[model samples]
Target: MTTNDEARGEHDAPSSRDPQDTDADEYRTTDQHEATSPIDRRDYLRTVGAVGVLGVMGGLAGSATGSAAAQADWETEADRRIAEHRQGSLEVEVVDETGQPVPNADVDVEMAEHDYGFGYVLSANLLLNETEPGHPYRETLKEDFNIVWFGNYHKWRFFEENQEIADQATAWAKDNGLDIRGHVCLWANVDAWAVPGDVVDAMGVDHQSGESGADLDPQHVRDRSFEHVREIIEHYADFEYEGTEYGSVIEEWEVMNEVVHVPGMIRAVNGVPGEQESDDLDPVTAPVLAEWYDHARDVAPEDVGLATNDYNTMEGSLEYARSAYERQIEFLAENGSLDYAGIQSHFGDRDSAVSPEETLDVLDRYAQHGVRLRVTEYDATGDDWSDEEKADFFHDYLKTVFSHDATDAFLVAGGSDAHHWRDDAPFFYEDWTPKPAYHVYQDLVFDEWWTEASGTTDDSGTYATDAFLGVHEVTITVGGESTTEQVSVTDASGTTDLVVTPGTSTSDCEEQGGVQVGEHCARDPDDDSLYEDVNGDGQTTHGDVNALFENLDSDDIQGNADAFDFDGNGRIGFSDVISLLRDI
Candidate 1:
């Protein structure tokens, strides 16, 4: 077996230098790192103080900051970066249908979803099949996160056997309004578990001897790989189920995984020319890898993002991993085949913990490559560490990554111990109860970073506020009339202008011993009416109540609370479901 040291190189050993010694200036710089305008450092400081970063940083004694001043400096810089990169001004205008300004209108802005992806690994099997035991997993994912990638069902081996399950999960995700990123089109690891045995047999080359059989055809290997890529990409790009076409639900696909560590397919395509030595290293700019990416680009939709994913690049210790990743990124970027540089930020038990400052330094180094960065598979699984220690690390690390301008998304490798590859690494315990890390995740992603504001429109019929970049629902209420519209806030300084006409109340539907729900009248369950069938099962049934119960906390139920207020309450709650159940 090839040792990691040998696969990298003798001189390219892990770095032992202190993170403070590593300067961002030493690497290539980009405009993304520079502040576009002056930021209020005091505001950032106050924000951090209110959020209690001091408590999160308390256990981080070995952090890059040696003194209180250094700690404060790091915190200020992080907050400043977040303010400079993540926020934008939102301006909403309310007007009549005749284009007249409706002054003094009440406006409420609530964030629907983040444009920046915050996600975790998902289990398709458990998600679709397991019910009571998996309720927390499903509900937490639906409520707390906005994106997901299947844990194993999307891999080549598992995908071959469970394509139906994977498709069902994809459909479910689309229905739930969650973004799905393709985990991998190909995993280049030489292990049998990664690459199917038939593919290895098709290669017809002995990995040990590097000897090729008569069936050794390089073109055939390329064709087979390309076929798989094309099939997976095209199928998901326009996935269809039950007469609904979920067009391009998956927007990103990892074209190749772990190319540096194991270049087995690269070797297979190169004709397996010589004896396979454990210590032999492949060229950093392997032509076959580039060819694979080019093929993927051709097969994928124009808007879909393609990435090269690998491990150890962001750990702040493995110099070889960093160097190899940088070279691969350079090669791919020059070839115009790279959209994202995937950083599998897995901090294992034995690996040295990278401080927040060091993590920033790592991001700075990769940001210079000009490709968007993603913390694709992040986990800090230290078995010996206490829960508080884990939580502290998660809090500090998420803030640091989310603060950086180069990073486009941050995804945990797994969220619950029940489905995690490493048992100790998940944010939740096996019983689906939250660990401290889970609370940290929630506090940062939802509470602190989220945006919600309300104000009355002035003479110009406008209400404006600076908010974090994302899709927000804006509701304009004039007198007792209200209208809601979703607006996308995409840029830091760019203004998202939304014009909404106030909607008037109307009771047009004919009531039949039932309540008026939205524009339609919902009759009693015994009438078996077509109205208010929440599950869309063609008629009212007990299943509709079950469906409403399952999605009580979801955005859909809360957004349309008035329509589903079966209990005649002003708000959506469990009592509404109980009332609906009793009616049935």
Candidate 2:
């Protein structure tokens, strides 16, 4: 009955749930609201997400009044004023093709610096139509990229399969010289969930919005979710190929994608002949998501970076930024189990959009709390955007991003198709030629910022490590001569100078004398039993092992001995049996 027994040769028959779907919580996006505030809920709906023109008044009512333009202008002016006081400290200009400084180059510290990289979505749901010269969408970017974010999980099924793709892409980027960034490991949306065999068979094919009155249980969802996260993170990071180094494929990953603070959302529903209602979004999903994220992080390779992503600049809406400021940080602190903060830069076409100044204000609000920020998914979307308009938008958007102090790294979204449903901006025109904006990005964002030496972890541009316990990479801008070198830091040592080897990659940086534990490996035996407590109630009581044993037969222990095997052996044996004995 217990996993220990099952591991100790007393094989228990599989239960109704599939052995693969160990954590069920991930599949069901149920709305779990602890408080009922009709007024507050309505207010959030009106001001959050994409704010309308009139919505600006309500958003900025606390600070100012009048049109959205006024609020944006005011926010911009305030940033300039504050930036002036902190001037020349964070702002670093990019060099042009002629090797001259772009004189009036205003930059954002946050967007330009923090762990910046870009990637293309490789999944079947979102891929460019294949054509001549290899995949048609590959040309959108120039050679020698620093980071490559594999867009979605659908494209990355197996380690070997995706590693081949990553190898090719990395080579292409390396031929041009590029780094690698992994988009996401665990997310509530993107339709990625580990469905058990029982749930599938019970609800036939076409599981979307069809199973009405299917009373889903939370415990089952939690179990399945745990299995999915452990499975995905371990499979990719630990899956070793013959030629490449271990964990070479994906260097960094986005831990949780666009986690929101709203409460109104639905998961599953059945619609009668002329009647249908939206399945409300989950409210209490943050903690479970956080737990899942933490689980993934525990199993992920140490060398890989995990990120929590959300929209950085709220679609030019005052309400967007305001709502984000009020609740975003709070959400993060409570459920912030990530290494990097992923901020989406999807600027929409609005004349009265929040200026770069306002964007920094929002970002700085979060940065004050000591969280590292990254511009995760950046793209522009709005009504009726022309090529010229798009190019101009790109320039302004990039300028605003580069000028901010809150940004750590920026990931510009690139793919073959923009999906007409979302916009008509041809990812590539009929001739497969890049748009003007793409060229601008190449010249302005990529060309100027990227250096031959920058790709190797040792370059001044690359962020070697966040000051976890010892030395880290710190950039010093002296007389406009910016350079990145290592610095020694500790609770006792504080921050002292450490030698940074130039022309080397971040991986090449020396592990300065400090704690060098699991820098690139999944969770070992000692830390694996820790995650069984799905609810995070803190005790390794009966409930924890029960959640783990639900999917024992699924071979879940193959990659994750730490989380699955309570006894810490490679195989789940008598120790696991003894641990789960009480759960039975």
Candidate 3:
């Protein structure tokens, strides 16, 4: 299924090397050194007819990519193509949800790992600034990831316990331009280590009897839960120093988390206390859940997107999971409080791995309700798999997610294995060396799906460009500072136009790896793996050809063979392969 910025890292090699290896540089150059013959497009086309294009393209298809120098030459051509297709200008228009142009506003656009944001669960300690000097992969989040959710860390009680650490985590993410989400504000199991056990237990135990074993009052539990949530959100979301209001750090939040798991203060579902057989709540539980959602929504400012978050809510194949989500969507849709329907997709066992079709179906089903969607917590946990298999899983799974228009973001529940919520994550190992998933992620996010370019609009308030299908951060620069908004540069025919005003200021906007003029930074063309042999067989032969073809029409960084486009055209065609054979 073709999805949206619907595409999809490497790990640390050395900080001293190119930082993008940390995510900085991303341009591919052709392999042609001064000693090698230049690429001749006409000759390549002529030879393709004589030798047959398929044989040329397929013969050494299984081989590795071209030599370093040849790869560089191809990279140069690819970069040229990207530049050539840069029909879209840097100016983008800001609009409210109603589609009206939001003019003259301070707009800031930055790219998230996923259109939403992707990475693992974040611990305050994982932050570089939060850690002591010489922490492992200090810039890993800044380099590779775009968002961090505090699953095991940054909780209400945890914050009260470790405000400094939580503050540091927020500071680091804010500094690096990463988005953030708070896991849970309220849950039935608040007594479980998430918040202060003493506080939650005290909420239930009455001192009137002068004993710890007092019966819990549902209303009392609800009141304390409300107060706790209010304080946390007020502290983080609507921060104030003295009478001056500081901007909020968290823009999105899990207003009611795992409501189906245990109805915290709700006490009963349809008159049943602690209904646990399935995720669906009884009539009693549903209303109470909605009340909590309303309360949380009321506590947060209008800018905040309050989400109804749950695990396995929409695997489709699972009967209870689908039923539970359907109920939640129905209830939230009615309440008009469902800003985001957060789904947790944890694929632990092979059987639990939902197909792309099933995942898309589920997401679409929810989309019909007109609610914003997010994959709040996700992890594909399969054992005894090769590195290639893991990488392949990450690519295909995300492709399915990216293809969907409603997908706001996708976050993995874990990051590094050493500091993971579970056993493993696709991007990291215990040692912090990037896994295969990391490389594939880099190719997709920074390469195939990323468009680093610039253009100017006509007399009309519009700028257009031919962009690959994906979500983009279109930052319109006004004055020296910049304003950014997330926009979609789609694959539809013709040019993708943005409707924002760029200030006349000549100040240049900062970008990650692409060439940058004033107010525009074309995502830097990746040049890192340009000369890499696909199969690592030490030759550019059948294995390489096979790899390139497999990725044909795919925006996958490891798949697209722009370097093989000998004609220096935007695409890889018959002539490109002939040119490769000549080089081989």
Residue 144 miss distance in model 3 (angstroms): 2.4
Error of 3 at 5 (Å): 32
Clashes of 1: 0
Query: Per-model C-alpha lDDT, please?
Result: 0.65, 0.39, 0.50
RMSD of each: 13.2, 18.9, 19.5
Residue 572's lDDT within candidate 3 is: 54
Could you tell which candidate, 1 or 3, scores higher by TM-score? Answer: 1
Using TM-score as the yardstick, the better of models 2 and 3 is 3
Task: List ranges where model 3 is wrong by over 4 Å.
Answer: 1-116, 128-137, 190-192, 198-214, 240-246, 268-285, 314-316, 453-464, 468-584
Write candidate 2's Cα lDDT for 1-584 as tens digits.
11121111001223332222221111111122122222221233234422232242243222212355764665465445423321221112233333344333222122112123444333222222232233344433333134556543312222223445434444444332234566554333312222333332222223332233233444544565566566556755543334322233455666544444211111211211111223443322434555666777688766666665554334454454346443544554556455566565555443433455566666676667556666655555455555545554454455555555555456665442232213323234434445555555544433333221111222223222212221223343424544443222222223222222222222332232111111211122235333343212223333333334333444433444555554454565333533443232
**Minimal lDDT window, size 10, model 2:** 2-11
Give the TM-score of each candidate. 0.73, 0.49, 0.59
User: How big is the positional error of residue 326 in model 3, measured in Å on the Cα after superposition?
Assistant: 1.7
> What tens-digit string does per-residue lDDT give for candidate 3 at 246-280?
24667577766666554544543232333224345
Q: Write the per-residue lDDT of candidate 1 for residues 492-577, one digit (tens) a residue.
A: 97876776667623332232243433322233444443225554322454445545656667766686666677766477765565
Number of the top candidate by lDDT? 1
Kindly report the root-mean-square deviation of model 1 from the true structure over all alpha carbons. Answer: 13.2
Candidate 1: residue 277 lDDT (0-100) = 36
